[model samples]
Target: MATHFHKKPNLYPAHVQLKVSDLARSIEYYTTIIGFKVLQRTGSEAYLTADGQTILVSLIEIQNAQPLQRGFAGLYHLALLLPSRKDLGNIVQHFVNLNIRLGAADHDVSEALYLNDPDGNGIEIYIDRDESEWTWFDDGQVNMVTEQLNFQPILTAADGNWTGLPAETVMGHVHLSVANLDKSEQFYTNVLDYNVVTRYGTQALFVSTGKYHHHFGLNTWNSNNGQAPEENMVGLKSVTIVLKDEHYAEEVKQSLNANGFIVENFAEAPAYGGAQLFSTVDPNGLRILFTLDGE
Candidate 1:
């Protein structure tokens, strides 16, 4: 399958780092239920990958970490984009066999399955509808809606085969529960240079780099006036975006500096092995890291 990583100057979500209370239990859940292969396991961390090499999710062991709170500015859901409708249907059937509860949605542009990890962190597994079928308005924004998902067609797409994540599966997007929509929008657009693709009233905003729908979803629906996660909270640790090269990374760093956003090089960042990092925190306290595509 062809790679889905966007081209140069476009920031694409690469992976997400989540803080979990139990390392062993979370590892089992990801490997068994989510069907991600364990790439590497450090002392207190385990790196998971789909297709055996492309790193996707990182699980850091935080012993005795506080369970994630209800109304905090943190991860709403980390979406895993599957290769095709048949791939999604196969996984859904596997979940059915295991009796795993899930929430389903047809967002017009995509079919999505929602569930939570063992630690209550949200996960969205989805496959996008063909671009030819996506509708766009005159305002240069794509139309997206939440409606009932017709599962019969999805089930019929499956061939009853079971396997791990496909090579084309990627971290399609990350949705965040933020405290303020305005601040989040400004930080993402002005500093990070993402174009505002769509908005929902004043409560939610979707932004993207290459105009393929949203790469990040920001919403204040459940976290209005909410505080950031505490130090010990088991929630989002950081979000990683892949740039094409060091030059592109520096260009983004310069842009962020021009917009008064502090840029730091995190020597201890989690993903991309030890690639150069341009890291900063959003208005709602979500850590965003930009790294090269490891070319």
Candidate 2:
């Protein structure tokens, strides 16, 4: 059988859940700076949407949530992908106007802007380059490099329209800081069946399905052999990976069990209501939700 990357459609990163020390402060930052609309707020938790309908981010307020520790196995960043370069330019201009300190990068597959939320959670706003423009290596890997981003050209492309995140926006990818590369790779690749698109030597690895560059990135730059974040620590709670095909979801459960990984099936839960999905923990103690279209 062909590998997962050669499949018809890839799994989509639906949403991310984060624990924050202050709900009000985090909500303001996400709405004003990141351009997310408040879908709903229930008690100490708030659901944020990019397209005014779907919940893409959730923030749960914890009274004594500890700050994320360096070199810990947890979230590195959650990336938001714009539908077009023009949309990215609009946000870039907004950042410039607000004097937000941003870090920019030109990865061969995408152009990205990086920032941190009020509680120091990492965020990446980016747009993917055309697939035809991507360069592929003989090893079935794509060339992705971090170089200086030319701001002038991107700024010139802006149409000067200031609005919130477009309806087509999506949670592009999630990068994680893991304790062990080999163990994480075994789970994400061997069991989950993602294709390794590329690597940054021994420090990082990128994996994707349907050959669309990357949906997940794992790295040990600052987290090698580190401990998992504490329960009350402010960091990643979980990331939802949505599979479009029901058969694929069943296959994933079988693969997880065969590989000795435990899987919990949630028929209908408030977290992902109306969907038949399963949850599993990676070697580094990160929660991954695998779901089908509907129950």
Candidate 3:
């Protein structure tokens, strides 16, 4: 799989925090079905890893947490990028063996399979086609389309041996349901400095740094003019973006302040281990945590 898109110098999502109603059930689903291993656990929270060390996803068990509702500004899905086509096939066969229902699609740049967790938090597992195969237009928009995925070819690539998530798996990208496309687009592109890579009419847009297809997919399909999910709801809590270093993190914080956004520092938090961490809410109320790489 391509590494440059997610490495230092490109702003990308590295971790996600989700609120779920049942910790054990969600843990079971993530481990057994999604192939994540537990990196840490507390009474009410669990951190998951694809490799043995990095925390890719976290689940916080909310007391009396409500089910995920539609028309809210929250998670659309957090995508997991696999390393190879063979790995994708292995998981597909595993899903078939477990009788899991899925929505599959080919997006020109990648092939993806979608499913939801026990708490209805959406998840996407996908493999990118080679970068050389991608099409770019003169206006700086990368071509992408949703079409039927040919499953037979992917299934045939499986070695019939399914384990867990590969060590190389990374938090590929995140798709969000937001209140307004224009505001969200401006915040992501102008304030956060991501370039617009693609658009689905006026309802949705894709943005990324370093010319990767996209690091974020923003859409108002179900959430146009809607409110954010309540704090006690079972859904996305925050998404963490790993910047290249403290310099970039500071730049982002300054940009947020300049744009009339509130940036809160969490640098002294024990959980963050003295990293220069800061967080701010987007226009639609989605919280985003900004931190440096290797923190």
**Which residue pairs clash in candidate 3?**
none
lDDT per residue for candidate 2 within 185-286, as digits (tens), equals 888889987889898888899998878788899999879999888789998988888776878788888998998889998756664312437889889988
How accurate locally, in lDDT, is each candidate? Answer: 0.85, 0.84, 0.90
Tell me model 2's lDDT, rounded to 2 decimals: 0.84
Per-residue lDDT for 1-295 in model 3, tens only? 7889998888888888999999999999999999999988988999999888888898999998988877899999999999988999999999999999999999999999999998888999999999999999999999999999999989888898788999999989999999999999889999998999999999999999999999999999889998988989999999988888777778898999999999998747424212438889999999998877443
Clashing pairs for model 1 are none
> TM-score-based ranking, best first?
3, 1, 2
Most accurate candidate by TM-score: 3
Candidate 1 TM-score to native: 0.94
**Would you estimate the TM-scores of all the predictions?**
0.94, 0.94, 0.97
Q: Score candidate 2 by TM-score against the native.
A: 0.94
* Model 1 poorest ten-residue lDDT run: 1-10
lDDT of 1 by residue, 1-295 (tens): 2234344556778888899999999999998999999999988899999978878899998866998886789999999999888899899999999999999999988899999998899999999998778898989898999999999999999998968777778888999999999989888888777889889999998998767789999999889889988878998998888787777678888988887778998666544433547788788878887787543
Q: Which stretches of candidate 3 lie over 4 Å from their true place?
A: 270-276
The ten-residue window of minimal lDDT in model 3 covers: 267-276
